[model samples]
Target chain A: MTEELLRLDGVSMQYGTGETRVTALSGIDLTVSRGELVAVMGASGSGKSTLLTVAGGLTTPTSGEVIVEGNWLSQLSPRQLATLRRRSLGFVFQDFNLIPSLTVLENVTLPLELDGFPGKRAKRPGLDALASVELLDKADRYPVDLSGGQQQRVAIARAVVGGRSLILADEPTGALDSTTGEVVLRMLRSRVDAGAGGILVTHDARHAAWADRIVFIRDGRLVDEAQTPPVTTLFEGADR
Target chain B: MSIRQSFLAILDQGACYGYQLRAEFDRRTGSTWPLNIGQIYSTLDRLERDGLVERTEADDSDHVYYAITPTGHDEVAQWLVSPVVRSTAAPRDELAMKLAIAITLPGVDITALIQAQRQATLRNLQELTRAKRAGGDGGAGDDLSWQLVIDSLIFQAEAEVRWLDHSETRLVRAKASGLAEPMPIDETRARRGRPARGGVPIDGKARA
Candidate 1:
């Protein structure tokens, strides 16, 4: 259950130099194990999204190492890093990042297809991913044809499709209403529960409660962390 | 809170014995509020004394039923139409007051306090969410009473977590404004003797 999928060791991210320099991330250490979804919560400009970008191998930290599945990011060449990201990493963003022209199935199959797999071969996995999110019937529909919630579900399917081990979601529900947002979150949670480790960066605490653990970020630093409260006996000491 | 009104309202639907009223409450509220038999009987006794309810004739099965008075029906009707008005005075929340006091003292880790409380509330919210998810999507019955009750709890826990986040931000701002600075007590009001009370100690890094 604790198989490490992603690990960030003393990761620090700084932009620019001299008077214009800014620290977007401080020395940070975090890990996501298979079957665990960790939620990162903070106010705006708190470096939550930067943490995701760094973890997903899109950006290299100024200091410290990012280890995804035991492969140190710093040691990887640009080609190796791109291959790792294409094959091992998945990213779900707030805008549902689907191409306007790509069909839902094509969008989900894009990652596998881009990794040198034939379209016909990737079709099965894409359909299965759609089925997992209960969007199989709408697989042929375009992104513009679906509701905000359905589009987000498609985004989740694309993220966890083809047995991808790690998922990085940045406010995946920001564009939907409360009910639709919950549906999208449930999809993300179900995928994580199926053994895909993930990091959910969100400002909404209600959504963060869905994760097994939640870490608070403040001013580019991890201030505190919490695990799911002991729930053996619900409302144990809370008087009705 | 007004168990009297609840009992009266249920009795308005139909007559019920003490034990039955407890069962009804459990069914209505998804057993969230465990109504013990002793409390049930005591409340029933009070209702009877207040003339809001009266004992009917014993049934053939030897079960005694309490029937609501006409006046009780009026009360139930009034309660249904009236809005629940919360008191304007601040609620007595130990956690809130503790943080209020904790922020004033030096060496106290207010962040830890808020995080701890947020964890506890999130746990509650998770359990409530899990239970709701597990219960529904099964039975066809449209009885949403349990769903509504659980939702109330979920919303409350969520609100509490948001409040903790806000509190942390406010604490940072307060520190920036020098509002959380500690001040030495004035020696001018010093007395020879002091009273013994279990008050917040003036000294010590409690976290340490």
Candidate 2:
């Protein structure tokens, strides 16, 4: 059995109170096992981004537990939580969020350095991550020097760099063309196949189709989950 | 879709035996459409009947070759430039009709149904993606027609998932806004027509 990487139990997030109150998430229970990619899909204002933030520990849920690698997030010290996030969690956003001034290699290794690994010691793993995305040769180049697709590949390299086992991606393909977006998704799939767990939040079903399972959110609650196995029933149903 | 047109187009290039024609079809189309030997013969027979092609005398190996007629060449030329026309009538899609019917029935769980279909469509999309990835540009010899077919299938599946999502969203909004109540058959209709005319003239029972 695959080890569980992350779990959200009865997770709910709220903003404000009374007249200004907004519930961004409600009693969401989810898990991302190692070697899995779970897609979260929903309409606008359905709280997909909120779920990723809560899962990544970027924001604490108003209720319930957020657990990463069997450790309860609420029980950790603030410094410990910061360390855990820096060491274990990675995030990719719609806009390729690389520091414009940093070279690709530096961006990838920054997480490791922040987690207390020496800058020099982080180079090998950072290079390995760049190579994984076929971007090793571009390590010395700045984000502006790369195409939108290449920059996103750099972002992905950063997300999966070192021992970071769980990735949270929110509309990662939203900025690229269809062909480029597919290439990036293929890279993500290869990473998950290489044994990392991920939660991909997307509004487009085409991108979500790359995931091992899909959970649909509605009004801040998970309304459905689908585990797909490259369906043959679609072609079989037609007598042609 | 038009095997006759394809056969003529291929024969326009040169004479070909029935088997050669099938192989040639597979070569160009990347075998997306499989043709049985009998189907090949049947199509050849029709083409021969229409004088679009003529059968040559059988050789010692009993292989019969077909050469395109001048009329066939003319037909091929026309077909090459002509755009295929789609029927204007609304298609009879069972899924859309079923969902339409389901939504009007109070007990049906439309959301569950939509989600199920969305999942199925997405699975097909993934499978198509897997197939495209595995095929890898269909090798170096030629441009892969199979990739185009796969792209079409992917787009269709994506459209299906998008429609399911759209339908579910519309349904949820309609339900919340009190527009989802079940409908009963109207009683004020003429005795003979479909859709039941709501204000047909009657013997004083119903009127406009």
Candidate 3:
């Protein structure tokens, strides 16, 4: 079986119409394996956001294919893609997209509720995911009552509550201070440690430091990948 | 390995302080490597905290003497044979990261990275050389210690520039060879070598 859980084959994404149109992604390809933490880094307008959108099935590519969890994204219907996203993918946005009226617990449980889970049972998973982020105690507080970092943690808890096999965080720590950012990063890293694959998007070198692999992107192209292997004697010699 | 192990490895051979370790590192690497004294002291403190080294009130007044623990001996021996874990922070290693990403990146202009590094290294080399020449031509009494340091920095900077030049040439050749094809994801995989598993290389042979 292919070890890759997500892949893009000759993918291209374009913006605008005809004469003035810009090619956001051109002839791009990428693969992310299970249990790996991959970072997507690029400068502004580099199609990094577009690639993340396509990889998460939030948008479609103009050409080529996106395969997630061994199933071709093109093969799935709109409803199927939506379902796949809910069950298999966890998404963290740059802004903490929690509902203002909802308490932290309610916001996290919303995904499970949308999937037809009963409110009472959904609460259990919501709190569990929150505990993973060390925010379970803040479950009853409204978004307005929480700080920006806390809200992001709530968003993270919501993303992971449904047992997603792949977690997609797009600049998850972009809104927090460095110390808080490190905390958020460690929380994201814990997912991979617990056996889930993750794709982290960040332009900050410091922020991307925790990834097992970092894939650099620019002008819609796959530039390079850095892998972190377990320390061994061979690694020391090779590094030297 | 623990901080104690590192401290013991450095001190077990002889009594030395943080500054001495920095000098020793430069000497062993043929003065082709330099370490910041602050980093050395910080590591030393951690080692001391871990009880790997005992501090002695030395006469130098400028530095403390450190003696290694027995635990340090066993640890260093094991560490020498153990495989080093490649750090994820490699991307932060200014030169290594630049080279690793030089080929695949678009819009980065590898020539620019190389040129910038070359210019900076050359500037430092020239500055140090001038300083050393002035020091040796002596309007003041000779201080061999400071002269040795300036000499070390000059050589190290020269070595760094040469290494960067070699890397640039390799990159240019790789691109000319058409091996720099628009980086396909699969091509990146090929360059990444065999997977972490004990797999053979793409050519059905074991990688040396």
Candidate 4:
């Protein structure tokens, strides 16, 4: 029995029916087990986004299996898939995407409310997640009032609340300054320490440096995957 | 994790000489990481001094092999889940520093620096491509190690060339549109986005 929390078995996703169709993923096989922090990197139009979306169950694959937490996503109904995504998975986008009108607390607790978690009790984990990203002090602030990096932290806080075991961040730091990006990355890295698995999709190798292993994708295929030592500092402008 | 703990973790797997440790580390990582033998020996000496490893002389071997102690085993387990301070020193991490400095100079052309880096990277990429095909090492024992290092370096150099090419284009467009100066934040408020505190501009001389 594999302890893999997420698995993709020979998966392929094709957009459109035929003729003018596009193949987004081809024969993809990947596994991310518990407590792993993996990064997905590829050039533009390399189908990295398709892989992330398919892995997170945002879209069905054209063929093969998408498994999470021991259940194949393809076997589930749409409603059940939605339920699974909401309860078991979290997402951080490049834009930070914190609701401008909501206070940081509200944003963090939004997923919990959607999942019918008791809001009052949810606040504790929400606060802890915020603190993990070093943005606890901004909890009472609105997204409009916070800097881009701070807002991204709030987004991360929302992602990890409710004890969700897997986090999928798509270019989460692309909008921030490098220094702030490093802080957000550290927070994500700490999630592995806190017993959650993460998959980060980014074009930034420096941002990907936080990951324990890097899986490179090119032309909708897994070109290479390699384990790396922990990064103590950002590698954006490395000289050596 | 402490250096001693890291040393023990590497040795607790089995007895190894300095070269063997370096080789194993490189091999396990698919040759993406290379640990120098000198660094391994120095770390072993420190571990021996700390009583975490016992150095036993081996017959007909110039290098002593080290075996981890009981304390070392316990330390390795602790280190597996330890909250390690991300190591700050990587040989190739000047980009973050450059980005941090760019924000300080409100109107300087960051693209200029990116271009310079891209040009240098492309030259290196060409050299590595030639080396990959030439098999210039005469098939030495360490030849594979050199090739692995070169491959990673080539990959990295190509990645950089691609990044700088893209970054410069976007930045050049931004500059042409009168958005050359990056958005600035107060040093105290700029935790991860901006450079080190106090808006220090990295000029050519400064980078040098």
On lDDT, the candidate that comes out on top is 2
Task: Order candidates by TM-score, high to low.
Answer: 2, 1, 3, 4
- Model 2's DockQ score: 0.37
Per-residue alpha-carbon lDDT of model 2 for B133-199, expressed as tens digits?
A: 6667445555477777777788888998888988988998998999999887768864664544544
| Model 2, runs deviating above 4 Å | A230-239, B12-14, B27-30, B137-143, B176-178, B189-208
Model 3 C-alpha lDDT per residue in residues B1-208, reported as the tens digit of each score? 2434555666878879778876766454334334567767787787778777778886757778877777667677888898877553323567776667666766677867776665555545545543444444222434555556555565677677667757866877988888765454554534455466644443555445
Q: Model 1, which residues run further than 4 Å from truth? A: B136-143, B183-208
lDDT of 2 by residue, A29-85 (tens): 999999999999999999999999999998999999999999899999989999889
Docking class for candidate 4: incorrect
Per residue, candidate 1 scores C-alpha lDDT tens digits across B100-178 of: 7777677888878888888777777767777766665324454467778777888888888888988988888988997
DockQ of each: 0.37, 0.37, 0.03, 0.02
How should the candidates be ordered by DockQ, best one leading? 2, 1, 3, 4
Compare candidates 2 and 4 on DockQ and give the better one: 2
In model 2, pairs of residues that clash are: none
- Backbone clash pairs for candidate 3 read A231-B85, A232-B83, A232-B84, A232-B85, A233-B82, A233-B83, A233-B84
Task: List the global CA lDDT of all models.
Answer: 0.86, 0.88, 0.73, 0.74
TM-score of chain A of each: 0.97, 0.96, 0.91, 0.91
Which has the higher DockQ value, candidate number 1 or candidate number 3? 1
- Scored by TM-score, the top model is 2
**Superior candidate under TM-score, 2 versus 3:** 2
**Per the 3 Å backbone cut-off, how many clashing residue pairs does candidate 2 have?**
0
